[model samples]
Target: MSVTASQVHGAVQTLTQSSDTLFLLLGAIMVFLMHAGFAFLEVGTVRHKNQVNALVKILADFGISALAYFFIGYWVAYGANFFADAQTLSQGNGYELVKFFFLLTFAAAIPAIVSGGIAERARFYPVLIATFFTVGLVYPVFEGMIWNGNFGLQAWFESQFGYGFHDFAGSVVVHGVGGWIALVAVLFLGMRKGRIRAGKHTNFAPSNIPFLALGAWILCVGWFGFNVMSAQTLNGISGLVAMNSLMAMVGGIVAALIAGKNDPGFIHNGPLAGLVAVCAGSDLMHPIGALITGAIAGALFVYLFTYLQNRTKIDDVLGVWPLHGVCGAWGGVAAGIFGQTALGGLGGVSITVQLLGTITGIAVALIGALIVYGIIDKMSGLRLSEEDEFNGADLAIHKISSTSED
Candidate 1:
């Protein structure tokens, strides 16, 4: 039977929609797996006595984040909701639903990043409560202002600087916000017991390097989907984004290897720092620019992580502030510097706008974190009791350890 032109066009449109939906679904799944990476990375870094707590926190936070974002965060950011009937929500091959799934992964990452810095010392329920407020309210405000262009912030940037702040995949929106909030939490919790005494610091080696390596690998692999699939449509996907991400990851690894002096922990975390830096400009940066950005991020992470541990009282367990907060801010600014046409980038970016936007994100994060964590600390408390911390969260909270005599 000869098909009518209208019918043929309809079929083609259906095919396109289905393809985009499938693409996004795969991306969402890949990003979802990153939670496992977060879990294992924390598991390996914290003391063996706290392994179970690390795993549990990531999982519980994932659940809490899902509900918070699904119910409140998504609406606040986009002014949309899933309150419609399933049939209505599933139109266009459920593209909106999968989009939520994809973006939800990013939202969930806020708590996951915070989890790393506050690991081993935070109380489970209190941290979970903080996660709900953060994911549901604090994060969405900045996210809306940047990505959704809400509140005319982007328009103001464009009016003054000739371009809105350009963060292709949320370097500041997600990573910077998460990292800075974590810094507040770390500060509120204070140093872990005996972490520092009389200005002398105690070094605690990772409990398991293999697990740490595994977690890093998972995040690395998942990051392609994080960056590439961020296009959110088949036609929008670019090989350039993938290439930039690759070069940045390699640069971070190589730089961290040199800067960190072959420390296994630094080596594993280096690539994450690079990826975080590149996320803002992966689409616009020349691969060479990406490499330099990643290298800077890697060196920055190694140096700052060491500085915070040894020379300061801030006991950030996994260096989220350096890897995510600092590098993420740099990514936002680097996009403007490296994304200029003169520098072999796609251009249409302003360094001034980038700096202002990044500073705004940091301000929101710091203020939100202060209020949320401060209130939670005052109301119900944030840290575990001294005895529980001394005994370790695994035994004290979970009533079990990672391994038992069988």
Candidate 2:
């Protein structure tokens, strides 16, 4: 009537595998929902006329990115492809497949990040083409080098410095690279039509504050999965990551509330700024350290977003350059700072190594973006015609609108 000890062990092993697979699958779903967050964030930030286009772009770009990553990008990053039969692919209970799905969400984020910067003006098909190449070739190159240890760069870092370059999640690999590339795309596309009418730049505000808040909320909720699930298995899971992420999120909110002078848009986006910055060192940082990191990121986003709009004449609508690019890079370097023994962290990191890795990531991203956006700009072009810009991307590209009342 009782089970054997061997049977108990076998049951436990099966349970562990299922738990890991389910954990990853849940992580993938959470990250996937962050795309919805991406869509609504763009929708709420853009003019009402561009809302439909914003939604469409996020969904369409995800499809294109998945295809690219599945067929080519995954191979480039990990040297592992699903070229085998169903049974062979089914090995490891298809956990690898789900893991692919998890990472693909991150890959798809590059274009989603770019979408906010180029909203209401970029050409549809050309952007899709660029996304294909960026995800397939550009992103995977840097991803492989950092995460997969493909180029011996991590080894070199360890040899030269005391420890390897550690991102933990993907402050540099995902957010930083995506932000820089988005900046280049924005530069190539130029300001939206009449963005600088009468020798003065006009300030356009978000049309839907509620939607914007919702987007931020979804992203904030899902980010725990994005950060925690990076552990990818039950045994590797840590409550510290969850607590750090929570602290960082609120730190960003409070900082933005102060820096932005209680602006609703800034208040909503504050948490996201925090989340992006904490992604690198979440595993190692103390709660207060994460808070400080997030606070800095929030201030950075507000100041740099304003600077780009006013001083630089760059129409990066989302301020992705600050929120993701600058802060993500800071997160990389901050990991070294806060992850040091003297700072009450887990230790095994160096600022010098972090700086080198951060700088290298920036260099790769900038170069890759310039080449891709430059070629596309010169060839098929990156922006819509003047008429299309005036008419709005919803009507011009998607042939639809957000409201039926009109």
Candidate 3:
């Protein structure tokens, strides 16, 4: 028997579809594990008395995010849903379903980012409510605007500025939006009780250095899957994306080592800062441009985190504002600069487009978060009572500590 050309083509298509589905499923799994990293990072950063709350909150936020995104966010962003019968939905190797799974991990990250900023002082249920609103509504709106070209915004940008915004892996769409919203929540909740005295902030050392490092390591490793698998198909994978991610991470580590003066916490978080900044341009930038972008982000994080902690009343626990918000915005702009051919890039970006898109993302996040968090604050209260805060969230909310003497 002879093989037909049409049969060969169909077989190839099937193989590609299966491979892509498996690829995305693995990516979703890797990103899911980053939530564990978020938990441990919070556990290591917050005071020992609040460690359990940190862990519990991240896990709970993830759960809320999953429900919200699966039911609401996916549809809001892409105008698609899982309302059909299972057999119908399972076509194309169920690629759309796995794609939803992958993006849900990103949507879920909004709450995880906020979790770090509002740790120890926030009421559990209120934050969960905020998570649902953000993941289901606020996040997907902006996500659709950029990634899905919703609302004709991307078309307008391309027509006006010669290019639309290009965020390869969601520096602005995910990290920036999450980070800025976290800023709102952190400011809304205020500083942890007794963290400030006589107009100066008291520094709280991390509870566990090893755990912090471990968490950073997990995020760093998982980020490859996060950035690379963002292509969504085998045919779109690029070695340049992988290389740029590597260079940017190393640049961030080195810059943080110098700027942070060997602080272990800063050291671990450096790669994350770099990775966050590089995400927008990872597919377009030269390794050198990525390095520069990452280096700047690393230094920026150290300075801003220090300033926010000491010189300002903004008590963003774990510095989510700097790490994700500022760096993510920088990533958006950097993609415009570093993605130009003059800067050793692939050349199809415009700085004006990037800035406009970045600003839009920030505006959406800030306005949406202000409304959601404000309503939640007024209706149900956002923070623990001083007594509960003083007792520590682990004991106050969870009725236990991280550990007990047996």
Pick out the ten consecutive residues of candidate 1 with the lowest summed lDDT. 194-203
Residue ranges of candidate 1 with Cα displaced over 4 Å: 197-199
- TM-score of predicted structure 3: 0.99
Evaluate candidate 1 by giving its C-alpha RMSD to the native, one decimal.
Answer: 0.8
Model 2 residue runs over 4 Å out of place are 1-9
lDDT of 3 by residue, 16-118 (tens): 9999999999999999999888888888898999999998898899889999998999999999988899999999999999999999999999999999999
lDDT per residue (tens digit) for residues 34-136 in model 1: 9999999999999999999999999999999999999999999999999999999999999999999999999999999999999888999999999999999
The candidate that wins on lDDT is 1
Candidate 2 has its poorest 10 consecutive residues by lDDT at: 397-406
Q: Would you list the C-alpha lDDT of every candidate in the order shown? A: 0.95, 0.91, 0.94
User: What TM-score does candidate 1 get on C-alpha atoms?
Assistant: 0.99
Query: Which model, 1 or 2, shows the larger lDDT?
Result: 1
Relative to the true structure, candidate 3 has a C-alpha RMSD (angstroms) of 0.8
The estimated TM-scores of all candidates read 0.99, 0.98, 0.99
